[model samples]
Target: MKISIITVCYNSATTIEKTILSVASQTYVNIEYIIVDGNSKDNTLEILKKHENKISKWISEPDKGLYDAMNKGVAMATGDLIGILNSDDTFHSNTVIEDIVNFHKKNDIEASVGNIVQHRENGKIVRLYSSKYWTPEKLTIGFMPPHPSIFFKAALFNKFGNYDLGFKIGADYELITRFFLRNKIVWEYSGITTTAMLVGGLSSSGTSSYKLITKEIQKALAMNGIAFSSFKIKMRFFWKIIGFLKK
Candidate 1:
């Protein structure tokens, strides 16, 4: 199946080149590379222009935010499958996309995801989060596959809808929960590593991270039609700390 990889960026001149090269180097030939930039003031647009020949489609203009940029990319995607790679992230290796496509084809899966390595700004690998074979119960306790490592059938978007622009930091989390938990989309868990994501991303940084996570948990619980208690939320945070420690 043809796949479209979207990279949404803004003022990411220092790192956008690596993201572009990662997608361009993919071994999968039937891939579409689309970049949506939010009118960056930095050299991000210049870098994109330099690689314009490799990009299937690119646009640089002001956008509502990251999710809005992603929505724009989704609207433009014409491939059978869609995946997103953030400007600060890269595929684990050149063959990653090829492997994902092969696995999906062989297994007849609607979605596929693998492991992700979280790395430092200087490209030092920090932690690895693996995608467990998914189950509805796992989502209740906050287990989620890394968003960048996920590839889903594009038609799923038509049924479940796109990322909710109403969410600032937790839109992706909400989307995943809505699909995997509420809508019960079929997915395959590839045991291979897919991407290396930069640590300290918006959802994992600063005091606001806590606020956004709280909102995410609420969103997930509401979708699952379950009531959440403060104690359970605290325990979930405790388990998250434990997961980090294990890393």
Candidate 2:
């Protein structure tokens, strides 16, 4: 299977090399690496050019933001499956892609998910995010599956549609919500830690950003026809606090 992995970044000169090398080093040979740059001002472009041969296709231009660049890459991809790897994240191991492909082909599922661990720049793992046997019924309560650790059958985008550009922070949540709730998309967890994410993202910034994200997630729930008015998303926030202690 030709799996397309996309990395979207703005100014990732310091860490883009690790992301590039991780994807390039995947044991799965039939892989396509695409990088969508947001017209970086730093030496990120230089780094991308240095490893241009490993990349199947790439584009550098100003985009609306992260989700916009992700959508662009999805449109440009010509693979059977698609997955997005953040510029700040890397694979958990060399065989992660190979494992995902084997699981998908064996189980015959449309989508697959894996675990992720959040870490500091010094390589300290802080939190672990895992969806242990998630189902569509559970998603109505506002629980989200691991986005970066998910690989989707590319054809599903044509069936359900792409991420909603209206959402600034919760587009990934919204897209998965639409897929599992309104559509009959089959998905399974691969029981592996596929991604190691660096901490300090938009959601982890501070209280103001967290509140904005909660509001956007609420909007997404509504847009996806999930009647979660009574569901307290604040509980999800508390769940993160619990993860720091438990995981």
Candidate 3:
């Protein structure tokens, strides 16, 4: 099946080249790479221009935020399967997309989820986020499948709807909660790490940002008819500290 990968970026000149190269180097030939930039005032657009041949489609304009750019990219996607890779992230290997394709073909499912390794500039592994043992209810504890490792069937958007721009940093969490908990979509999981997300992205930027995301996650859980309290939201810090210690 044809797969479309979307990269939403803003002023990511320092790292977006690696992200584009990762998608362009995918072993899977039927891949459509699309990028939505938020009118960056940096060399990001220049680098995109340099690799324009590999990009199926791209646009540069002001956006509300990250998820807004993602929604725009999703609207432009025309492939059977859709995945989002952030500008600060790269596929763990060239076979990442190939694995994603085979996972769906082998199982009669519309979506596939994998694992992620968060790393630093020296390539030191930080935390390994797995897609294993993920239940919709586990979301109550603030555990989520790695966003970069998820590949969804294009039609899931039509059925379950797109990311809620209403969420600032928790759209992915909210979307997963809605998909698995509220809508009950069929999906498969793999143990392989599909993406290497660079540190200092949206959610991990700072303590304040992390707290905002936790609050949003709590709100998202309640919006999806799951009972969650602010205490459960605070529990995220405990889990996050544990993850950091394990690294």
lDDT of all predictions: 0.85, 0.86, 0.89
Those runs of model 1 whose alpha carbons end farther than 4 Å from true positions after fitting are 223-230, 241-247
lDDT of 2 at 140: 61
Query: For model 2, how does the per-residue alpha-carbon lDDT over 1-247 read when each residue is reduced to its tens digit?
Result: 8999989999999999999999989999999899999999999999999999988999999999888999999999999999999998999999999999899889979998889999999999987888775666666656777788889999998888888889878898889888877786888878878899999885669988877777887888788777874346756766657655794
Which order, best to worst by lDDT?
Answer: 3, 2, 1
* lDDT per residue (tens digit) for residues 1-247 in model 1: 7899999999999899999999889888999999999999999988998999889999999999999999999999999989999999999999998998888888877788778999998779988878765455566766668888889899999888898888878788778888887878888788879889988787888767876687677776686575556456546768878766886
lDDT tens digits by residue: candidate 3, 1-247: 8999999999999999999999989899999999999999999999999999999999999999999999999999999999989998899999998988888888988778889999999889988888776766778888888888889999999888899989989999999999988888898886668899888877879879978988889889989998776776688768768766885
RMSD in Å for all candidates:
1.9, 1.9, 1.9
Query: Lowest lDDT 10-mer window, candidate 3?
Result: 228-237
Which residue segments of model 3 deviate by more than 4 Å?
239-247
lDDT of 3: 0.89
| Candidate 1 similarity to native, TM-score | 0.93
Runs in model 2 deviating more than 4 A are 239-247
TM-scores of the candidates in the order shown: 0.93, 0.94, 0.94
Candidate 3's displacement at residue 188, Å, is: 1.5
